[model samples]
Target: MQNHHMITPCLWFDDQAEAAAQFYTSVFRNSKILNISRYGEAGQEIHGKPAGTVMTVSFELNGQPFTALNGGPTFKFNEAISFQIFCDTQEEVDDYWQKLSAGGDETAQQCGWLKDQYGVSWQIIPRILIELLNHSDAATAQRVTTAMLQMKKIDIDELKQVAASQ
Candidate 1:
């Protein structure tokens, strides 16, 4: 069986790939562990495993498939790629921002971009970012951006204050 349009986001971990995958699947609703498979032979000692360690694990997050691979310490999650959460309200933003920022790094950018404890980046953006960017002028948008550059979690009121400034 296969879903033609299902494309899973693969994650790489030093040795905690399975643990992290389970954690994520547990945190999100409409989610569960789909499958877990160890390496065949190619990824044996290369991954500090017996050649059949956890080569890959498929999980679901909010019904989305995500694969985690224990590929050793060759690569680590950096700030390059980040997941953006489009939230409908400030409360939603606060909830996710707080949860993701637990033991994570807050970049204090114009929007909501932070690195979680596992070094995985997340953007707790409001769904209004697109609307705000569309409706406002560059000058006003610049002000909002300026305000946002000062803090994290993106307080809607604070962003409005910047947008309203002359």
Candidate 2:
């Protein structure tokens, strides 16, 4: 087991903490489930979940530690928070987008952002996007930004073409 960080992002789930943890670990490299803590009798009384049920699942996605709490549906995931995955190539971006968005809300996809089946928002972005959007030339940056705004999965080739155009 690796040492945990002082601050970790905890995802709240209704009763799918384990499933979500597994799914996330499978998608990201160097990721795995670290530990699973079950609810005790006292905890069950307070949380209303049955004793021995999953209380929290600690996992790592690409070495980034995260915790999934099976805390009832009192709160839901929204676009206020999202995970950003940076990719060096279009194939990398496409793979992640396809896996994360599988069975997710397709309608929520916009500008390289999508809501997963668990309602968690994620941004599959190409690394070159920053370079293009932060180009020394303001006009070039604007062109890249304009092209990105009209995309959903983010086509790096298209963005490159747009940047090369006059």
Q: Which candidate has the top score in lDDT?
A: 2
| RMSD after Cα superposition, model 1 | 2.5
Off by over 4 Å in 1: 1-3, 40-46, 106-110
Least lDDT summed over 10 consecutive residues: which range in candidate 1? Answer: 102-111
lDDT of 1 at 135: 57
Q: Write the per-residue lDDT of candidate 1 for residues 131-151, one digit (tens) a residue.
A: 666654888777766676776
Task: Give lDDT tens digits, candidate 2, residues 1-166.
Answer: 6665788899999999999999999999999999999988885557999889998999999888999999998999999999999999989999999999999999999999999999999999899998999999999999999999999999999999999998
In order, what lDDT does every prediction score?
A: 0.75, 0.95
TM-score of 2: 0.97
lDDT of 2 at 98: 92
Q: Model 2 misses residue 143 by how many Å?
A: 0.8
